[model samples]
Target chain A: MNEADVIAALRALATHPAARGLRDDAAVIDVPLGRRLVATHDVLVEGVHYTPACPAGDVAWKLVATNLSDLAAMGATPLGMLLGLTLAREAVWTADFIAGLGRVAALWDCPLLGGDTVSGPAVLGLTALGAAAAPLSRMGARVGDELWLSGTVGDAGLGLRMALGEMAVEGVLLKRYRRPVPRLGLGAALAGVASAAMDVSDGLLIDAARLGEASGVGVAIELDAVPLSDAVRALLPAGEAGVLAAAASGDDYELLFTAAPAAAGAVRAAGAAGKVAVTRIGRVLAGAGLRLRGADGPVALPARLGFEHGRGCNAG
Target chain B: MNEADVIAALRALATHPAARGLRDDAAVIDVPLGRRLVATHDVLVEGVHYTPACPAGDVAWKLVATNLSDLAAMGATPLGMLLGLTLAREAVWTADFIAGLGRVAALWDCPLLGGDTVSGPAVLGLTALGAAAAPLSRMGARVGDELWLSGTVGDAGLGLRMALGEMAVEGVLLKRYRRPVPRLGLGAALAGVASAAMDVSDGLLIDAARLGEASGVGVAIELDAVPLSDAVRALLPAGEAGVLAAAASGDDYELLFTAAPAAAGAVRAAGAAGKVAVTRIGRVLAGAGLRLRGADGPVALPARLGFEHGRGCNAG
Candidate 1:
């Protein structure tokens, strides 16, 4: 069925008397006597996010990781997740998938409570729920807040490119694509330290622009300051490739946040304590547009943007 | 990719130190205030759940409804949800899909929070979250508990079969499949009343069998007492089709709960007050096996079971 029909069917079912107008970025559960819950969901389809050749365990791990990445963006701690698994009539593959999920859940302390299973084309959809101290949102940044990005960017995009045979990578970047690390603890710790934040699933520039849009502020990013992993640097065509890589690729899953200038030291301290890297990449400005500074001068920003699923397939 | 690779890709994400294993039916979130959040996810593939001609709005509505139905089965209250949207590259259809979801979320009060969008071979996934009262589960029913079902059965099944040209229907039943009612409030009300509960999704008999297995008990369903909609009754082949429809058809989304005889009155009162039908059609016993009475002695149950996606495209 077309999306329209499907949405209609869903709407008809989800419409309970008290749950009306609950369609927002997160569902609002009114806790009568306890803490509120923050929940998020995401799905990765085959031939879209990964390939048939990718290990099934890797795919399962990525599904949970990606959703947790969203919770990390919100500065929420991992609660648990439910998996909706679709197998292609292969019992062996399904067992491995579950085992893979079990391993990571054990490592992350993310337990599998329950979910549904069905046979179909191979695809994995995971819904992760986390507890919020004070629900972190992408729309809470303030002007003049120091913009920070945790960990390096563009590795996953490069990793995917390598898998697609468009680039050659010998090490970590490929691993980055296969397994992108989400800055979970760093993000959660930033809950009080940062004014606004979100994960960078889309490339940095685009996601920054979105953060700015959501926060009603402008951002000025120093192109040279953005963190680039050595792996990403080695595979790029040139130094300018950093900007290109950061701007046009996807799957970074890093946390791009804005904090008060005074809070930078404390934020970095927390990151260091957690063994996660935090870097200053830009600053939130009281303007209307995003400006990128370069080595020569203000170069024309790339007209093309980050991944948009079906829309950006031909972008590169 | 195999399930292993998929799991690997998912598990490699940044993790919180306290996150428990996240590969389960419900995500357990520590609210820090003595409140635990239980989360679950669901997806309905096109041409698998409904005909491709079904409206996109309906599909969107169904996606939320189905997940909410899960929460209802757990005796949980609505919280919020995340949407994983995969557009078909058709702007018109995508707009309609969003609109329908908007309507449902607005009506249900469960806002669509953060979700990922991708372009793919056309699939829709929605993960919904809800608050649990005391961790209701499918494995808590005791032997000798009375098995009760809310509302009529066989309507959605009959409607689906009718859509496939395998049967005939008059009214309501067709609408039931098009938009099955999820008894969220009623289900939540039964949290303290029912011993074990689950939604009637994979046919009454199969799901009842599941509940039985989960509780280490047996179920004896009185076919003569099973409630059926007038549409179902009118379409059934005289004599035995009524029982078959009740046992074999699915998509009812009604609550199948087992409660002690002492709690039956409260359940009946709650059901009536909630404006839903409550029917007692079976009882839990201390053994294993499902038995159904027929017009002439106990007849052998249908050898064919409930719908299993990808099994037979022509299966009714």
Candidate 2:
């Protein structure tokens, strides 16, 4: 299909009242009373963000999911999203991509509001709008705050290796790489309890350093306490180096939060309610920078922390 | 500069409290009481949207202006915007682009919210947010309502020709094609008076047809009454064909609206208050489709309405 036909298909999927049947130039919706609106935008390019051979549906799903993850980190409830699709001339690919987008949007209850479509290389962008009564921030973590993590990290990195044919593993690892679930419930639960929070998109160590830098504190992470999925353990060596590598991997999409030690029970309760695993991984210190420790002693930080795109480095 | 360096420069420009100094995962802002929020997203690819020789600042300016124009069409007040910049590996180009974006954003009083940036082929996307008391819509036009236009049309089309070296003229036309002023003031003025309204990004006739079609009515455009800019008039032939071609050209970015004949005085007053010229170029009819009338009689519709991208037709 051409741009017009693809737009027609998108219009059919955008049934929300705010969409105005995709006829209006903009979507107008009432922001709930006394709630602050959260907004985030992310872009996914064809080769840089995803493999060209990756399913178009997965690409679309990732586009929406990644943007929504930003909202989740803010402890916000997603309302809707606007898509910016620069498409190639492929009818089947476009249909599949839209189908995936509709499926994910419906699953998350985030409506498709409005967007613009144009002809170009495959570059998909999504801007998610959400609302929160009291949003969390990375600047609020104080010294002596306990650092917590929800869900395991580095599975996606392993999954990416498998997807790229560098490894020969299958099952949950591949799924983790292709589809990441946003921790929206846990984030909302952490809104009042957690002092500071953010999702780990880059490596955990790098993101931890960033969190500490933002809050004007330091982080001392017990490497052994860093959660790792069973799949990752089964594939990698059972040693400190293996755990460190996982900690330095990207695409985790797990929430890393900090709260006072007195709020541990409440954090556990919130984690239980959200049906996510909660692990105490570290503690905030009075100074800046990050320190990693294993069962024996402190380990020196790696030269490279995490993925840094546009700097001639691998994103995965 | 790398992504981090670019972000540092952007952080200085993002002064809104909601921006959180671009440190948080997303920006959170409180919506004012009793107001609906308007959202719109648009993308501008490097090659497809503008010529490679075009200034990066102009490209950035047009990107924000065009998206703001969508908000203007809805009669919404500009608030903030999120940028999704997939940049090429050119430090100078990136700096120039961001400088232009910051300039336009500050000029329009729209704050820079948090957004994501990555390395890839240059594809710029922006999601603009606005607020409205009672936003206008294109579905509100009634039959017999007079169609009105703010400012003259076809200047951008002529400007594009000049930019492409098809014309010898240099001054206003090129500026029109490069930097369009979104008729936000006029649109806001007509909010309660106009029955239906939209901005003409595509050609006047095509966009008018869209407004009419959305309202389930037909439009009768008098070719002689259609307003033309002095630049367009001086460059084109003095006949029906010249007017037709001008009306069929794209990138006008003028306001096309409908109001009851009885409300014409109010419409004129609103236009004058907004410091824009208002002209009656057509009228809403009972049925569907568009009718073009010349000095002699009714002229048949052209084979092609306007620029249709990615359909093997010239957008210029």
In model 2, which runs have C-alpha deviations exceeding 4 angstroms? A309-316, B309-316
Model 2 lDDT tens row, B156-238: 88888877778886689888888998888888888889999998887888888899899999999999998888778888888
Q: After superposition, how far is residue A120 of candidate 1 from its true place, in Å?
A: 2.8
Docking class of 2: medium
| CAPRI quality of model 1 | incorrect
> Mind giving the per-residue lDDT tens digits that candidate 2 earns over A143-175?
899999999998998988987888996868887
| lDDT of each candidate versus the true structure | 0.68, 0.87
lDDT of 2 at B164: 77
DockQ of each: 0.19, 0.71
Best by DockQ: 2
